[model samples]
Target: MNLNIFRKQNVKTYLGEDIKFSRTLSAFDLIAMGVGAVIGTGIFILPGTVAATTAGPGVSLSFLVAAMICALAGMCYAEFASAIPVAGSAYSYGNIIYGEFTGWLMGWALILEYMLAVATVAAGWSSYFASFIKPFGLSLPKAISGPFDPKNGVYFDLVAVVVVVLIALLLAQGMKSSIKINNFAVILKIAIILIFIFVGLQFIKPSNYKPFLPYHMSGVIKGATTVFFAFLGFDVVSSSAAEVKKPQKNMPLGIIGTLAVAVVLYMGVSIVLTGMVNYTDLNVANPVAFALQYVHQNWVAELLSLGAMVGMATMMLTMIYSSSRLIYAMARDGLLPHHFSKFDKKHNSPQISLFVVTVVIALGSAFFSVNQLTNLVSFGTLFAFTLVSFGILRLRKRTDISNTGFKVPGYPVVPIISGLFCIFMMCQLNKDVFIMAAIWLVIGAIIYLVYGYHHSQLENKNSKAEEA
Candidate 1:
């Protein structure tokens, strides 16, 4: 075993190089991007489904719990993004503070998070699209509307696959264009949410709150674990640190702002949604729009269904963009082929990585159901969040690192709680999720041993310097 795999990367050397990404993103742009990513299928679909299956009306409290966990992790992430300002997010942070092996695993886990997140959202988007068109008596063929379940009559999710490919094409146009589309989608998404809240408020029966804790506290905790997927996108903002202007100032604001906004929207929608309809009846794919239709607000429901599709498209765009950047960052570190590091100069994007990611996500969306994809995504994200929380504690002890960036408030206590909470959430996930994540990590370790260990750029650089 080459112990070089456990060697830490030099922070100063890593920070000193230009990574070739465009630095055109402002704090507002970063916020828009994060907001665009955070408020999609999680809000549109998960709230009602989680309520019906796990929390009942207690789903609102579940959102709060998930938000607090994310806040703890978000502060840790803010400190890292401000100080490192790199594209790899947790992968780069782990490399500098932990070691090559730990970094590789974090990057591997993030690959699962971003890729499956897009697939899960695409699956949700397909359902909303079906709902949106059905008002005109139009419908997708039964076999093409959902996943490949022979017993259920679903052969392949053609809509999900098509939407994923379209988002990939849009991202290939580059960051600036994608951000513009994200901003527009975010504004429309927010407007639709507000309309749902106010309009749905008038229809609340007040009876839905009776059995709020129908499944008890255990169910609330379970719902928090399940809906944790709603909070996954805030970290994607950290992945954009390399592209932001004055990242030291903007990164923290963007990351924290994203969580703050998303939490409020999630809680408000969860409450109004459960209030307007019985939790048992809210388990359908297009929950938000369905609530309005239940109250005889058909026109509003149709409009909301359209907005949901637009909202999810932005989420897919941000996830795909973030995933490609992670691949680029890992390749730049010699953990993968250097060819993956090449940017399309004309577009200022990683076109090759985008293509590879698009294929994987499209396939996942076409074959897997949303529920299967969602749990796996939550597990991958929690795994990364756990590493980042503890990685910050180690970073604080380094004498060579600068103290100029944002620091997690309350220091050791905050990060400790953050790390423990992530583990607790992981425990709350399905046992099947545990099995799948273990398999994923085992595959990652094999790749590291075969290729990354031999071709490591840092190892080669250090060996050459020693000979001199």
Candidate 2:
């Protein structure tokens, strides 16, 4: 093996990657990014569901356990993102350490994660929109609202499709404007949640929390899976690695600080909301609104509903933003069409790439409801994270990648434990989700064997032709 060739390939990053991101983001901005991504359905909807379905009012415990898992994985990612400080987030990390196929696979799985995430947010928005407008007895008909669910009894969701496209158009506009929009959305969402905590505190019934750990050990495990979705948005912080100023120092601070605030918010909301009504009667589909409705606070529910709809819009925006960037990076390396990698110099965004990404999202949302579309957002992310955690441990041993400012505290132990935690949560997923995630992996494998292997940027066609 020629060390010089290997070094040269590493130097190019397989693309004329430019330093476009401003290192101006402080810890606060990164924390805002995490909050924007994490606050969606998980906090607004899932806690009630987790409490009712698994923990029985003891959902606060479930959230704490889930936060522990998130903390472990977040530490590893913070280390990698700071060390690499490049575009593509985990996709770049995997590529630099594991080679082309693994890298592309990570990037590809990320698309699935973000797409499904957007779909879920769309579904959430649709549900909240219907709930909000129902007061005047005006709401979307079942055909548009319920969204074709044999299990939950839905019948086609037009609103969801519309929402996905709307967010896509916003992101296609570019990053500066997108960031401003996201900032506003994040503030609105946090304010709404604070209102719920303050106004709903008086309604708490101590009897509702009788058995805090209602399900005990089994319940805790179930709650972990339910609330794991809340932890989903923290990784969006890493997706901004390409744009961060001093990504090394800022990434970890952002991840830890954001999760800390998010956890406090999650725990507070779960406790107050469940205490307002027995966890048994809380609506899993639209948990927070249902809880507010339970306490006869119809006005609060309506207010939260509007807030939620706007918040979901921001959620879709941020998810699409990071995912589209990953696709652009992957395309530039020839893993996907080169055209998809073209950045709009004026907008400083991958405009063509976003167009294609939005097309896929629009089509998916047009057909699938949040429930039926997929439950594997958590799965793909978990898999990618497992790669990143392990990658940090592997890369740390090689000096070439050690120029990063921030590093994980426990080295082999921290990353190894994080990898284990990822697998644990993955196993907790439903069998159907497990099978579906496996199928996605198989598809990635096939693509790698057929195309990625032949066109591998690692083979260095430019340099190879020179040698020939």
Per lDDT, the best of the predicted structures is: 1
TM-score of each: 0.91, 0.89
Q: Per-residue alpha-carbon lDDT of model 1 for 1-468, expressed as tens digits?
A: 535678877765455434577898888888888888888756878899999999999999999998888999999999999878878899989998899899999999999989988888899888878877786899988988998898988899999999999889998998898888888888898998888889989999899888889999999988888787678878999998888999889999999999888989999999999999999998897788788888899888777777778788988988999999899888877889988878799998889888888999999899987665567777888888999999888988988777687999998999999999999888877788899899999999999989987877876554554454
Off by over 4 Å in 1: 49-56, 137-157, 205-222, 278-287, 367-370, 460-468
lDDT of each: 0.86, 0.76
User: lDDT per residue, candidate 2, 1-468, as tens digits?
Assistant: 322212222523522363654445567777877888787756777778778888888788788888888888898888877777777888777777776667777877888899888877777777777766776889765555645665655656787778777777877776667777778888888898999999889899999888777788789777877787677878878877777777778888988887898889999999998898888887567788887777788888777877777777877887888878788777766767678888786777788878887877766665575665456887888888888878877778766655547787877898898898888777777898878877887898787667755555554644653454
lDDT of 2 at 195: 94
Name the weakest run of 10 consecutive residues (lDDT summed) in model 1: 459-468
Judged by whole-model lDDT over C-alpha atoms, candidate 1 comes out at 0.86
Which pairs, if any, clash in model 1? none
Highest TM-score against the true fold, candidate: 1
For candidate 2, the C-alpha RMSD (Å) to the true structure equals 3.9
Q: List the residue pairs that clash in candidate 2.
A: 23-245, 147-155, 147-156, 148-154, 148-155, 148-156
